[model samples]
Target: MPRKFKVTVNNVDYDVDVLEIGAGSPQAMPSYTPIAAQIAPISSVPAAAMVAAAPSAKTGPAGAGDQCAQMGGVVVNIPVKQGHSVNEGDVVVELEAMKMKVPVIADRSGQVARILVAVGDGVENGQALLTIA
Candidate 1:
């Protein structure tokens, strides 16, 4: 006998029939069939909309005094802006990776000189997020 199951993968839903085969049974194998009509189309959401809010300041090129990302991830928040005073170990940017939120801390105390990335931007390890001067 075949059992019907509804499965969702990557935001898409599918209806599939699954069969079971026992040892020493006459049937050599079990198969499954996915009903085309039951599948739900996957929808795309804009990256900017997925984040809490977009960065308010303009981003500039990387330069001296830049604070960098320690790991690759998507920018979730920017807690400091250009010209904002920050202290060493202060959280300046938040990143989301591997289903975890990571805080990017300031390496030195200084006024923010520049913002190099915005919320919803994907950053690589060691990439500059902002600059302290």
Candidate 2:
């Protein structure tokens, strides 16, 4: 609450809290300090759910079970659903992020035929994770 500087010359107006203004002298405009460490310490939650918990949502179809959203994460673990019968690279589903997990394999063999996203949802990056007919 201590730092006032608002000077205007000509019509006459001056209010200085004094902080040494001399180099060229002309300091009078300072009032906006809420720099609580450059903002980022309130954290009651809600920063858009911490950016939607990072890269989450948008998967449903690429090969076996169609598992396509190649990069987004959160499903964490699906194992295999639909008609179940993978082969290519198997792994089916298992994505996470920050904590890192991401699997989503099986790019060839078939049978799963349709599962999309479950266990916890939230996928996106490339979306379409399931459908190996």
Candidate 3:
């Protein structure tokens, strides 16, 4: 594709046509290119590893996991269960994101009334992770 550019140097004005390289032009694309990449066979991964990759269902108490707060990543661990007493700053859940593990701590001293998410569940940046009651 050719892009036009205008430049002024000193008192002279110039218009230039620049040719873009690579894929910007439709002609650069192959007509028969596949719509998706082909995935390799999963034989290399152990069955246990594949199973561990999945997140489990929500565990412990019912009724909207109260005091839901936003946190993003995969629930890697739930160290505190429902009815467990905790103090402010006690780790309740551990999240894994971008190859880093982050511990979700108790915001206030109270019993963990519910564990809304289970291990392996994907979380959003502002989605509720759990509640303290």
State which candidate has the highest TM-score: 1
When 1 and 2 are scored with TM-score, the better candidate is 1
lDDT tens per residue, model 2, 22-111: 555455555577777567664767898888777543432343334575676688788887887888987888889889897878778879
> Candidate 3 — worst ten consecutive residues by lDDT sum?
60-69
> What TM-score does candidate 1 get on C-alpha atoms?
0.56
Candidate 1 at 20: error in angstroms? 6.2
- Tell me the TM-score of each prediction against the true structure: 0.56, 0.28, 0.49
Q: What is the lDDT of residue 106 in candidate 3?
A: 70
lDDT of 3 by residue, 1-133 (tens): 6999998999899999987767677868657745444554688688999999975434333234353324567888888888888888888888888898988767788888766788998876555666777
Clashing pairs in 1: none
Stretches > 4 Å off in candidate 1: 1-20, 25-63
Q: Which candidate is the best by lDDT?
A: 1
